[model samples]
Target: MSVMLLIEQVLNGLQYGVMLFLMAAGLTLVFGVMGLINLAHGSLYMVGAFACAGVAAATGSFWLGLAASLAAAAAAGALVEVAVIRRLYDRDHLDQVLATFALILVFSEGTRWLFGSFPLYLSVPEVLSGAVTLPGGIEYSLYRLAIIVAGFAVAAGLFWLIGRTRLGVRIRAGESDREMIAALGVDIRKLYTVVFALGAALAGLAGALVGTIQSVQVGMGEPVLILAFVVIVIGGIGSIKGALVGALLVGMTDTLGKVLLPVAFGTVMDASDATAIGSALASMLIYILMAGVLIYRPQGLFGEAH
Candidate 1:
């Protein structure tokens, strides 16, 4: 109810939104460029978290762990692309989904076997572990604010990479017409592998970043993966800008709804009932938002009209 609480919630929403953006960006890119439905993408997220936890524990350096997350995820993605996903490109979405679902099982079980069922924790570095005062005299966690900054930095860098680089041009060309791009002397297969690896790295970065705040455990990526799907669908499947916008929208709506709805309902209902109903609605808000977007703009907010 207080102004400080409101500010803190908004900041929380922004941090969450940015993390979702990181995850959704990769999903959108992979879908746009490769046309593959990878159910195992979330498994890559778990992989990143595990790698970060393991490496950080061994080396006592969060930075090294972060680097390991990126490298391990990228390598895993490339290997998957070459060994399994490449074969699924020409197949139907159903087949792609099934194969990737199998991958999820393999990844989850494999990680459990390697790491055991116990959850791992990643500690925020000492420098980032404290709070900073905001302009309104509100103290906020520095680590969370750092996440927001890092997320935005990555988003901007990704936009530049996709919009200004030669690789971006090739990616666009591949997205538009894979066969034509191949005819034009591009190694389409290699390009797809690179894109998948890049996407996987982004997901890994998100996982590593979040692991500091939450426990790293098996199947940790599934819920976030579903949310990322909602983000891509609401934003438009292949549009990065849409993914960004949709992620922020979903994040704010979900966060604000949870915080504000109960108060609004308390006026009309008992506190307990209001809390229950508000929580339920908050969980459904993003999906409802996605449905509304689909009804109005089938292609998505930033998607090209088809």
Candidate 2:
């Protein structure tokens, strides 16, 4: 491939990685802190997309839609945690999974009932709708680049929140010993709700950001959720740093594989066959990478060994 094309693909990979990080970050946090298997987390993502689309359509402003997404998703997460998740904390993973899976159905049908079976469209804000030139005369989508920047900014903000804030201290404490923190006067229940809401807001922001590029529809979050789970598994269950690293690796592997694999195969095979075979292998690259990582570091790159 040409140098310019390669650079563009790399950038695309970064954008996709950022999206995955947003989804995975929340998922890891919830799993790590609450020890809850939340199949319904994806539902919060769908909620954000729908909320963003609906509000933006009503208000004629994407900004309002974005805000609505964060609010709606956070609210939904908090409500879910209070009404359902708290009960599951004392239950086994099987119960958590089954209950949350039921939640997926509740959310899907509820959304379909409200929005109909048709997909909703979200337009990129006017200011972010174009392309920009890079140093080597490479042109890239301004919106995608913005997403990469925003994702990193969110990462930095999360680091600051976790490392510098009191709530961060509480979160860390809760992860280590929820009972001790509760004994020390921390409202463990409140902390769980807040953390869950924060995670939900992140997922919502991801959904809203991506909705502009894709259709905002029911069940949209499920596929992304699967990838997010893979990301957390590869990165280590609860490590944000691991999530970011794992997401970038996955994004690069998946994106570059699709581009490069076909060309590699074309060298020795018929063009049509090469494309077909290459695409199939490209689909397997991330899983292969995950398995390799497991072989080398069973706890993941950043996960603490048990």
Q: Residue-wise lDDT of candidate 2 within 171-222, one digit each (tens)?
A: 9899888999999999999999999999999999999999889999999999
- In model 2, the clashing pairs are none
Model 1 TM-score, all chains together:
0.98
Candidate lDDT scores, in order, read 0.93, 0.94
Count backbone overlaps in model 2.
Answer: 0
Q: Whole-model lDDT for model 2 versus the true structure? A: 0.94
lDDT of 1 by residue, 1-306 (tens): 998999899999999999999999989999988898988999999989899999999999999999999999999999999999999999999999999999999999999999999999989998899999999899999999999999999999989998999999999899999999999999999999999999999999999999889999999999999999999998988888999999999999999989998999989999999999999998888888999999999989988786
lDDT of 1: 0.93
In candidate 1, position 30 carries an lDDT of 92
